[model samples]
Target: MATSRLGFSFLLSLFLAVACSTVARQLRFVTVIYRHGDRSPIKAYPKDPYQESDWPQGFGQLSQVGMMQHWELGQALRTRYSGFLNKSYDRQEAYIRSTDCDRTLMSAEANLAGLYPPEGSQLFNPNISWQPVPVHTVPESQDRLLKFPLLNCPRYQQLQRETRQSAEYVNKTRENANFMAMVANETGIQNISLESVWSVYDTLFCEQSHNLTLPPWVSPNVLQRLKDLKDFSFRFLFGIHRQVEKGRLQGGVLLGQILKNISEAANTSRPQRLKLITYSAHDTTVVALQMALNVYNGKQTPYASCHMFELYEEDSGNFSVEMYFRNESGKEPFPVALPDCPQRCPLQDFLLKTQSVISQEWDHDCQVPSTSQDTEVIIALAVCGSILFLLVILLLTVLFRLQAQPTGYRHVSDEGEDQP
Candidate 1:
């Protein structure tokens, strides 16, 4: 009996040890996609007093408020990952990529200023209190993979058109017709549609955010409707009809790339040089990625909002992907659940669930005929061409024979082959 008790105690101890170790998994990597900080409205509606000259940095440029917003974000990041990241700046440990836009690039620089405040020998100038950390970017004209609102995607455009014609869309449009027309008249923009109403709202929102007075025609109710419209637009942009198909073409491309990075980071054989990767881009970029993940909250993501991917390695030789979103500057990032997934979702499960949305060749899928459709068209065209070719050959042969036999001159009239 004593021997039995001793064996059971040993087994219990081993089980406890394993359980504790499993709970203490290590964070292997992190990928964060954040919107650029506040900015002037990209453009103003017709007859709006605010213009390019109103902003010191010109239209669409990051403002002083924007810089401070990102600076705070950097501080938040540093605080959130204090022990997980190196105390000193390590180029090999982190990678940052941004859209090649003035606002996005500048936001990245500002965020880095807070994220990696120079310490020890890394500080170049004691008075400046900042160091230059490289923020890499591909020009907007050349970048399609990382940025959202991807242009020239024929498939996505077709999906958008279909979505607009969907019953839900038509109902919404009909319901909002009176309000939309009111906006068009008040803003003095002759052809303002649901798609373009955001610009007017954005102009008003930005001006209000900075405490500027608004036009008398605008009211709190008007602004609320505008905000609602913008939210609807984002949903329409990414999640309307055939949500999965739209995702596969637009945002899923980026999601797949991010998953690839997570898998590589989790691999034990790979030389884990990169601990963190950050994408500095627009709010649309954030919304599109979240929509593909099926975690979007159907609201416009606030400026400086960040969607983070945290990769973890468990003691049982498994990896997991955890997501969080920080849409408010003053608040902690909330957990974003993948559908039917645990907060710490297993990497294999993550891949399995997202596989349907992951696109292999985004451009090819967006531009050309689908493989099955193309095959049917090709077969039909081939059969038709073969029949046409035979007819052409027969006609040419008869003409040749007739010409060969007609060498002898024969008097011919317009009537009945000259009655010869």
Candidate 2:
């Protein structure tokens, strides 16, 4: 009887362990891309009262509110990933990257402060609670990863031109003609198309967020219209037409990097120690990424919004990816499902589905057909070839005539000698 009771307890303990292991999936890797916190307007319209001098740090700088926003977001991230991440900052286990903009860099620092406050041995100074963490960045002109609407891409520019000519774009333009004219007149911007209108909206939005009194022309209804147009512009730039090709040129650049990281994490044979990677970027970065995933909701990404990718390894050794978007403060991030993929999408399927947008050679892909330089080169070559052909023809004709004349003259001389 004693032996049977002991055996039963042992079996029960083994069963519970197996059950717990099966119920909990092992989170192997985490990738997070977040928009920078609140910022001053990038630029003001010509007629606006506020100029670069009005902002505390001039145009496009991060404000103090932006700093606090990132700090809160960092704390939230810390809480959510407390179990998965290290208690203190570990350079070996985590990497952080930001765009080379002041706002994004500052936001990354603020977030790091909240995410990894100094603890124990890491505490350098008694007065300060934060420890420095490295944030990597490349210059904006060269940064193809985080910057959206890559202006240097001629093919992307051609696509934009095509998008502007699309029926939907035309219809939107016609419908908003009067409103656009009003904005143009009031803002002193003569060419207020969909592309340039967003700047006006951004300046107003930033000013309102900071409790500045807007002009009478910018009524609540007008502001709402501007916001709607701004959202539409986001969709227009990324998704209006030839979306797949545009994705290949724009957002796919960043997506390819992300998928590569996930692949490395999923590799069991050659495992990487890094568990978390974070990108501090702008709202446009968020839109570009979501657009590539075919999951953008057509709403402007808010300040400090975070898009997270969590990779998990199941008990059966299969790996999966789950996505979450944390747009609002004080709320749980909502799950984002890839189009035609399950909520917990298998790693292979995710990669296979996204392969179409992943450009193997981004620079080569951005090349436009019949570029002006190419056309000029072709024309120059054709002109030079024609000139060379004409010169050869002229030389050949002159040689033939010279040979014929010499033969006739020699025959005449021989006849004259015989007569003598």
Counting clashing residue pairs in each candidate, in order, gives: 1, 0
Q: Tens digit of lDDT per residue, candidate 1, span 1-420?
A: 999999999999999998899777888899999999998888888888787788777788898999999999999999999999997889999999999999999999999999999998998898988999999999888887667777688778877888989998899899999999998888788876678888888899998987888999889999999999999988888887998988898789889889999988988987688999999999889988988989998999999999999998888888888999998988999999899999989999999999988998776779745764388888999999999999999999999988888567787667765444
Any runs in candidate 2 off by more than 4 Å, and if so which? 1-18, 370-420
- Residue-pair clashes, model 1: 1
Local accuracy of candidate 2 as per-residue lDDT tens digits, 129-188: 999999999999988899887889888888898999999999999999999999999999
Where does candidate 1 have its weakest 10-residue lDDT segment?
Answer: 411-420
Clashing pairs in 1: 413-418
User: Candidate 1: TM-score?
Assistant: 0.86
* Model 1 ranges off by over 4 Å: 1-24, 368-420
Question: Candidate 1, overall lDDT?
Answer: 0.89
